[model samples]
Target: MEFSNTREFARSMDKEDPLATYKDEFIFPEVNNKKVIYFTGNSLGLQPKSAKKYVDEVMDDWANLAVEGHFYAEKPWWDYHERFSEKLAKVVGAKPPEITVMNTLTVNLHLLMVSFYRPDAKRYKIICEEKAFPSDQYMIASQVKFHGFNPEDAVVEVKKRAGENHFRTEDILKKIEEIGDECALVLFGGVNYYSGQVLDMETITRAGHEIGAKVGWDLAHAVGNIELKLHEWNVDFAAWCSYKYMNSGPGNASGCFINEKYHELKEIPRFEGWWGHSKERRFLMEPEFQPEPDAHAWQISNAPILALAPYLASLDMFEKVGMPALIEKRNKIVAYLEFVLHQIDEEVESDFEIITPSNQNERGTQLSVFLHGEGKELFNYLMKNGVIIDWREPNVIRLAPAPFYCSYEDMYEFGQILKRGILKI
Candidate 1:
């Protein structure tokens, strides 16, 4: 489809957008008595209007029912997390039993590593992308140290070639083959946070398995923004936070995915809690740990209902529109944004370059613009003008036109504001 830099063309596209009505579902921040143009869903999603309603329901239940709310509330607190299974399964493309909502992203990553990252003497190395999210880097390094291995010796990183901004899939596959015998695990972020590159998860999983290693993903950016098939890909395990593309509140509860094949294996080691015990035997308080026969077995505590409530509100929207439909709108809006940026560069004769891959398949909603000469000045200028985008270290501005709330006109207006900022700089 062709794109134009004109405001009227963008407005026309917004009018034709099938998912345009979803804009009203979210509450945006205002600046100078006007709604800001928000494009930071990759960092923090705008809150959905229904989030307040769902959270209020939980508060009411707690107020009215007290301790009996576990069994007597409209939606029982004891099983609050269970309500997300089907909805989250649909979002991540897994069997309902294979998915469970639990602790934060890094905590779940550590828990999953306890079970999957069994590094014996012969196979002690783990392969991951260089410059992974700090939490993941810390988790992998700490886990390697816990197993009595030095991080520098035990962790293998797939890095970009000199002068390149992203890792090539062939290079990653070759690295998996090169470290074949010693690799115990291959863990990577499904969508890289800095460059916004989406990895080839299925191929990575296959290659890791062929090398006799377990494969997992930190799907913090991929979970709600892109289509995933963890079960079909045969991924060993994965985890993600709800606040980014999922549009849940800050520090919300997270979701985890474990292959069903691992469910019935009683020998798998995990840090246990009562919530993970079989539901029938849970209240009986037996001494032995009787794990649930699914992903819930990995849970370390009971659900945080207030945190889970806002997530439910967002998941309901996902269920209503479905991922395919959401992604369809996402692709077009991102392309339009890309087109608008290119036009701004040409008009202003600036050297801003997009570091994120141009291929739609290799990215989600984010476009990481490398501000070659102009630094945070341009970003600050835009922010002052109520154009909300994110700034990373060095000199990159990240903008994500989330499909649910951001409209095509937002992209057009952003481009105009960016051009004005560039001219001033």
Candidate 2:
């Protein structure tokens, strides 16, 4: 794995990669007819070559079968949502019945919150990370406001020490203990979008339950990129968007999960719709809602077959590769990227830091680079040079070398581009 320089090492790794063939499965972006180094999968993944064909099937059903597509199409659009569950369950480590393809990520979060975030006067506070994704923050604030409470008083945000860039597990555990008695819920991103820090879900779940608080996860960045054990970890509920690592296209259908323990808990209130009704009685046009005995109970409307098709295709690919194998390969490639970045000399190192955790277990496929000066300028230079990493506001750039499409050569080329970009800054 040693490289004479970034270039030599990247070339050598690309030659030996067992998954090297996968790079060709995607349609790489071309600017002026040259393929760019694409490291922005954390933002939006490149399209799979087969995605159009996969989507075309659904389009065919819609065009030819129309409303009858619900039951008569080749894939039977009636059960199209079901087609994606098994494969997605494999990726997220959930039982098939415990998962469902449903609303978009933020919408699913709000739905789960409506069922889980029941705040009483004595335990009305919610605990979350300080820099949670904006959608999550907004959802929590709105939920608290809906419950007739001010977010300033009802939401307790956990933060790292002022000088520290990453969250420490000890600090998170301590904060949970400090607020446990008053907290009604603990919802956090499995892997933070900005810092790329992967929280210890098992430990956090246990701590929240011990304090009698419900716990959930926003897994938009974690799914497909990291291994999950939602059932074993006793996560009450979780939701994720599939547009990023899942390669399901922009603003695609999302998935939801509920722990099996909740299936029989009739006392827990839920937001109900006809889609969540038990299939046997759903056609009966019954007025009272009898939910499908598992996670599908959260669905609010009929499945979007076209949107679900892309997710099904993406999940099929994940099922073929298996999460453990994908993660193992991702670790090596990301580590290689880190090795190159660290070699960029003392001056460059002084100007930036890798805010993502150093331990492979503490992150997914992303590395969040924090720049000390001229952040936008550096980002613009890299983009203009055809190195497509994404820039977050203020001072950071997120580069994710996804296992499905990115190669070691892309990482090496990025290193060269980054070095040249910084010199101009």
Identify the candidate with maximal TM-score: 1
Model 2 stretches astray by more than 4 angstroms: 346-350
Clashes of 1: 0
Which residue pairs of candidate 1 clash? none
Model 1 — which ten-residue stretch has the worst lDDT?
Answer: 297-306
lDDT of 1 by residue, 239-284 (tens): 9999999999898888999999999998799999999999989999
lDDT of 1 at 64: 95
Candidate 2 overall lDDT versus native: 0.86
lDDT of 2 at 371: 84
Q: Score candidate 1 by lDDT.
A: 0.94
